[model samples]
Target: MENWSENHNDFIDYERDEKNKKIHILIIYDISENKTRTKLVKFLLGYGYRVQKSAFEAIVTKSQLKKIIKNISNYLDEENDSIRIYRMYYDDVIIFGKNFSIEDEEIIII
Candidate 1:
């Protein structure tokens, strides 16, 4: 999660968006080392809920997201690890499953 990710562009401050407004961030990581991965997970957990085994979703301010990226970068081995972060809206998400509910909401089984 840096300025060089091919899957994402640089973190841009949208001109239309207000400064300090909170936004949803989805972070998914694949690290080769278990220790590093575990540490990253622990750090991320303090910021948001874990959506899956290796993914986390947080509602953080732009500065908070930037801080996360800055701090986590130190623990990353870019040659062997991959971490992707996306900015999205919580309402845009739809679920289709059982036994999994975000923020204690009921899960829809279809």
Candidate 2:
């Protein structure tokens, strides 16, 4: 929303646009290897919230999305692993089973 293509190098300054608001990312993956799956989960945890065993929800900017995809690509086995990244608007998301919500505060895992 903040002209990400022009300011690709400065992701820290990326801001949400009034039109787009927030970028909600839903990540779903299936990896045959246990170790790879664990590593993938760990990597994703740094950038998102795990809503399920193999799914995650994140609020990210365009540059951050690019970086996350690049990181995920490195761990994926083209032949056996599958990863899906769904980009949607915050208002478009619908949650049923669990009470999940995105917070504006920083999450610290200690």
Candidate 3:
């Protein structure tokens, strides 16, 4: 029988696509400037991303993700802004939910 390590190695042996699929990503940004956050949210939505409870999730291509992130980064205030990008897998949100309460979950992306 194959050992666990052998099985893991077998799994890793398969060829995987380097290109990112149209996977959903959660993007969290801190835009303390009045109306800045809202405007940016609108911009993302207008570009085909969805915004939920201050978290944005969308099926973005890898190239598009880079462009979107660049646009967002450009708008951020160097000293006061930040963005958290999360790759949304099947259970990531549920796993994280264990540590964050419902209210706390409001700010999370994945």
**Number of the top candidate by TM-score?**
1
lDDT sort, best first: 2, 1, 3
Residues 65-93 of candidate 2: C-alpha lDDT, one tens digit per residue: 77776567766898888898776557777
Q: What's the CA RMSD of model 3 in angstroms?
A: 12.6
Preferred candidate (lDDT higher): 1 or 3? 1
Per-residue lDDT of candidate 3, residues 16-47 (tens digit): 32443444567777778867777777767643
RMSD of 1: 7.5
lDDT for predicted candidate 3 compared with the true structure: 0.54
Best by lDDT: 2
Clashing pairs in 3: none
Of 1 and 2, the candidate ranking higher by TM-score = 1
lDDT of 1 at 51: 80
lDDT measured at residue 27 in model 1 versus the true structure, 0 to 100 = 90
On the 0 to 100 scale, the lDDT of residue 102 in model 2 is: 73
Question: Which regions in candidate 2 have their CA more than 4 angstroms from the true location?
Answer: 1-22, 105-110
Indicate the residue-level lDDT of 47 in model 3: 37
The parts of candidate 1 lying over 4 Å away from their true place are 1-12, 15-20, 98-110
